[model samples]
Target: MTDEFAPTRFSHVKAGENGWRSDGLRDFFLYRDLGVAEATEGKVICHLVKANMAPEKGTGWHRHEAHFQIVIMTKGWARFMYGDQDTLVSAGDCVHQRPGIVHYLYDYSPDMEYLEIVSPADFKTVEMPAPAEVPPFTPWS
Candidate 1:
């Protein structure tokens, strides 16, 4: 298995190269792969994630089963509950979410979009209880 990804090659995904698709991550977000998963043979996955639906209810508290994970806010802003701290990640912000840190993305702008990269492409997500009750979402229009 390791031999297959021994020499991870390169990939060039140009603008509008890959179309968006709905996986099982979030019902309101659409993702476009950047060919990192195939290039690295499931070692890493890089993709652009965009909010496609309104923020009626954001992603509930959940933790990813990954060794490394990061989100770089490229457009707009998003409110997230990281552990017990409520953070607003805006454009130009990069967040390195340590593995197993419970978080809830509760609100975001219509143009909210970010680049998310994670290790072990086929990582798992385990739903957990929220650390604290989340406040009402602020209007995002």
Candidate 2:
């Protein structure tokens, strides 16, 4: 009997192999696909995201419809509001965003970059209302 699910294949994405593209979820950030989704046959997705421009208006309040999601900051820092609490995520920090939790990334440094991993590869993001007031962003000189 053949199994309904196909086996996931191994994947190796060398540095500089795939170019960063601006056609991601946010226009202000660039995304570099790491080939994890393809290798896993849509079971998961891993990608690197970097700032494309200075902070003006950050990502509006939104929630991702995903079973599992995490962000690992690789450089710089960012400010986010998860529910009513404001949290700062910096380099070397990791944040696991619980499924359906309302959050918003309100500010970030110019060099901010992070590795994001999510399940199901193709997740949905729904806009949400702000839970509280967001702090002002630091202006880049």
lDDT of each: 0.91, 0.94
The local lDDT score (0 to 100) that residue 125 gets in candidate 1 is: 92
Please report the TM-score between candidate 2 and the true structure: 0.95
Cα lDDT of candidate 1 equals: 0.91
True-structure RMSD, every candidate: 2.3, 1.8
Worst 10 residues of 2 by lDDT: 1-10
Q: Would you estimate the TM-scores of all the predictions? A: 0.93, 0.95
Runs of candidate 1 exceeding 4 Å displacement? 1-5
List the pairs of residues colliding in candidate 1. Answer: none
Candidate 2 local lDDT, 1-141, one digit each (tens): 346555687899999898999999999999999999999889899999999988888998999989999999999999999999999999999999999999989899999999999998999999998889889989888
